[model samples]
Target: MSDATKLLAEKRTEFGKGAARKIRRAGNIPAVMYGHGTAPVHISLPGHDTFQALKHTNALLTIVIDGDEQLALAKDVQRDPIKPVIEHVDLVVVRKGEKVTVDVSVHLEGEAAPETLVTLDHNTLQLEALATNIPDNVVVSVEGLQAGTQILAGAVQLPEGSTLVTDPEALVVNVTQAISEEALEAELAEAEAEAGIEHEVAGEEAGEAAAGEAAAEGEPAEGASESSES
Candidate 1:
């Protein structure tokens, strides 16, 4: 929703893998513009600028599309599995006053009751809000909450003009009693025992392989020595 999310776009005439590769070589990102009952338009954007703008979740982009100014929201981004380079991006056209449904991160604030552990069941929740006024994040309080306490989706407060799209009864945060040191040690011991068993199995397999090789060599040498003596 910031002016920093503006994108300078260039219409892409070329298609296929070769064109996309060429675009990447030129330090640009291949992106698609769709949605709002419009045709999919292929475009290229500056790589570094696009990456910075996309740091925001559900970022509202002021795009210069085909010499016309249009507002859009980042719908999806495809990135390389092993590399940090982005592969493609999907943008959805939107109006300033339009209410769009998006997921916003829920951050925990304050500490729970002593000796209790706070577990977040949902990190983000879906909500409908204005395109130009999307909330950055929602904060949930865990102040002095005891074990077995759960916060539902509907119980969280929303920013102005925002409505929850997720199920109201869905659990968002759960506070539970912390595990004892003995329990943790017991779990670790079990894991170590399992690993030791696997190590022993591998050692036995290696020993068997060595024995087979030694027998194979001895048999050949014995036959050769007998023939030479005769």
Candidate 2:
């Protein structure tokens, strides 16, 4: 884990949407901290500082409330759908040596073999590590990997003192034969046929066909041109 960022919080005495809105308008966000069999503490965090600190889900935070400090992790954050606003946050307390399960991102480093598509079967791996020593991400190399190659969770190396919480048999990365556009379309068509799906002509193609039919109908009858010339 990266160094914990300190955020000052104030104990909250008011509740409900109105109070929460009032808190936001005052440049703060409401949050609750609970863990280790302790009663939940409701407080408000500084808006800007908390936002910056909680950029990553696995961030470690040092919450200071009324001259007391507690280590925590943001378990959940609620944000407004249409606005850049954080409505609420749920924080879980942690001790220095406490182990916590967190999902760490899997980063691919190299290219797979030619004519192969590399797929990330699982983007993140679940790991149990000390609260203050969690890794930001796990890197896996696919250099020169050929089609049909798969990397399982058990095969991945973990940071020292970290334990894998994910199932060992979980597929992490897979390499498969790449499909060409023509092959992809053909496969889609075959699947659609098997499903009894009928596709209508595209708008542009339908318009062109209609225009050609109209022109054919407007053509003069056989020998009409000859009769007129005579």
Candidate 3:
């Protein structure tokens, strides 16, 4: 968790897409803070500073508005789909020691046993932790796990004071035998067959089978004619 970063904010009066565009043009992100049964506050935050501070998940921020500071957590951040800019932010007022549920990322470390493929069933786990003590991520060690090994959510060790909100029986990782290229292709072929998809090889084979089936009927084969012409 990163230390709270302070940012000076300005209250936004004008509302609409046009106003939001103007705010972004001035290098500020339009944001709304709501929580604790209080009225929502519409404000504008410094674009660069806000983006930097929000790099951490569940980022804690000290939002200073009109010389008054409020503690907030970056609950949701909207961004341009194609750009690296934050379009808007949703802040939830949080007090110290308050518990909040969030989805924390799962990071895998160490390698599994040889000739085994490690599949991460869950990339993140739902966790309930203190607002000010939210962990950045949960780490899982695969180490020397062998094939057919499975790791469940309950088996994962979470950070201190963090409670897992995800179902304990949920599968987190599965280790399986590594497949050869030929085996993978065969599996794909079987799946495509089930889906009624045909391979180009089947069509090509019917069209070019020895290119000479007509010869048995006393007619020049297409391949023979083409070869002769060539």
Please give the distance, in angstroms, between residue 48's alpha carbon in candidate 1 and its true position after superposition: 0.6
Encode model 3's per-residue lDDT on 1-230: one tens digit a residue. Answer: 76678999999999999999999999999999999999999999999999899888878899999889899998889989999999999999998878999999999999999889999999999999988888999999999999999999999999999999999999999999999999999999999999999755685676566555775676665545444545
lDDT ranking of the models: 2, 3, 1
* Model 2 lDDT per residue over 76-179, tens place: 99998998888899999999989999999999999899899999999999999999998989899999999999999999988888899999999999999999
Runs of candidate 2 exceeding 4 Å displacement: 185-230
Per-residue lDDT of candidate 1, residues 1-230 (tens digit)? 45537788999999899999999999999999988898999999889988888877988888897678888988999988998788899988998789999999999999999989998999999999998889999999999999999999999998878999999999999999998999998998899898884434586676677667767887542223344665
Candidate 2 lDDT (Cα, whole model)? 0.92
- Report the error of model 1 at residue 216, Å: 53
Error of 1 at 85 (Å): 1.4
Answer with 1 or 3, whichever has the higher lDDT: 3
Q: Which candidate is the best by lDDT?
A: 2
What is residue 87's positional error in candidate 2, in angstroms? 0.8
- Identify the runs in model 3 with alpha carbons over 4 angstroms from their true place: 185-230
RMSD in angstroms, candidate 3?
4.4
